[model samples]
Target: MKKIERGMAFASRHVDIFKCPVCGEGFEEVMNGSFSCSKGHQFDFSKKGTLYFLRHGVKSDYDDIKMWEARRFVLKAGLFQPIIDEILSLIPEKNYLRIVDVGCGEGSTLKYVEEQRTNREDAYVGFDISKKAINLATRDEGSAFFCIADLAQLPFASKSFDVILDMFSPSAYGEFDRILKSKGLLFKVIPNANYLIELRHMLYEENDPQYSYSNDKVLTLFKRHYPHAKIKKITYEFPLSKTFFESLVYMTPLHWGAAAEKIDAALAKGLNKITIDVLLLIVENN
Candidate 1:
């Protein structure tokens, strides 16, 4: 039997529940039932019993190794320490034995937390679509599974994970919902509107078409799959340097711009500092 099929069969035994906020529709249990919309929008289940209803299929090859290395440096510099602290604080006391990091890039966050956490042993799986990312994560023997897979097609059983980490990555809500158990928690770390204000100021046309408003956008998207969603926002200032400037230049989404020439000119002024406001959402499976 295929791995996914086995998971679905097991999940069906538990009798799962689903709801779509966009349509105000609910299904008591879809353990063995088909998933569909009245407007003919239907999503089929994988062998693992998770449904994928991704309307858009956009995946791209990330930047080169130099870019990845820069991101690794910034994260390791502890500039985003506030994010780490908030995540540790919100973690509920539970006997959660399985955890997964969706779109886990290079596994730095998971590696750090695993060292402090004795709550669960070898329960961490850092999954990403990029084999380069997965290879980097697998080097950490502390982590359990490192796989190159799509979020919309998670290779796990329904209600299998105790916690799902969606940190600064594309979210697959249906897959997240399918993989989490009733008591499971999803820790989503989204960028607040002012996340990288200095970069925005430098890149955008007078701070218009900003990336600052992603918090509400993300919440709105996820509220479609789960109820009782709430956000916890944290703002912090990071001391910067020449290396920090390089890291920010390439690692951020702000790097893409039609006004690249202007942005480069602004950055040359040797302005060596910035702040980040992040939203750490702790949404429970309600």
Candidate 2:
């Protein structure tokens, strides 16, 4: 069988999670490699085996091939292992579960977390806005299903997931809540002001006011959506070896907006290590 066909076959197992983004009708996964809505909206599975649900053309900065490539390399180095360990610790010890990762860049984090799971009944699926990222993610075909999708208008049915992961990704809380089961958990990981403190300092001047951010508004919004949410502030410094430095800077969008010369200058200075400061919010879909 062809690669795309096999991919579609694997994706067929969890067809119930999806609905027509255009008409809101449930999809029928045709074994021939397409998902069709009752209203005749048909979506094809790419040859790489990824399903695309993004109706609009790719517009995100993450759509670049280099970004995904860099992410793939850096993540493979286990730089995010500490964060992955915490994520694993929070997962409910269940025999069966559905875990959906939103904006799962190249599926690194999802794949890593899924690897630590001994439960064979767990179903892991990830979707992102970038086709490049989805392509990269599908390399681990049977491990998890990867698709190109919109975060705001998720193509899944209401209450389709047991756990929704929003790590460093944009959130559509209403949409997220709608698709998450009543008993579902949303594990959202947002960067703190100190996240990549060294990188930010390098990107801007020491006294540069824009070098920092305020997650106060973000916290307020999150609390408004999930009143009983439990927040864990995870802060630590991870050593960065010279081997991973290039991928580290390239993988992150933290310094992408800076001038090339400035970035080069920062690289010239060399980085021994950096901080991984983030807020992990565990909230119920209730």
lDDT for each residue of candidate 2 in 22-44, tens digit (9 for 90 to 100): 99999876656687877889888
State model 1's lDDT.
Answer: 0.64
lDDT of 2: 0.83
lDDT of 1 by residue, 75-133 (tens): 77886667876776677655545668878777777877676576555366666665555
Off by over 4 Å in 1: 1-59, 93-96, 118-120, 207-214
TM-score of 1: 0.73
Error of 2 at 215 (Å): 1.4
What is the C-alpha local distance difference test score of each model? 0.64, 0.83
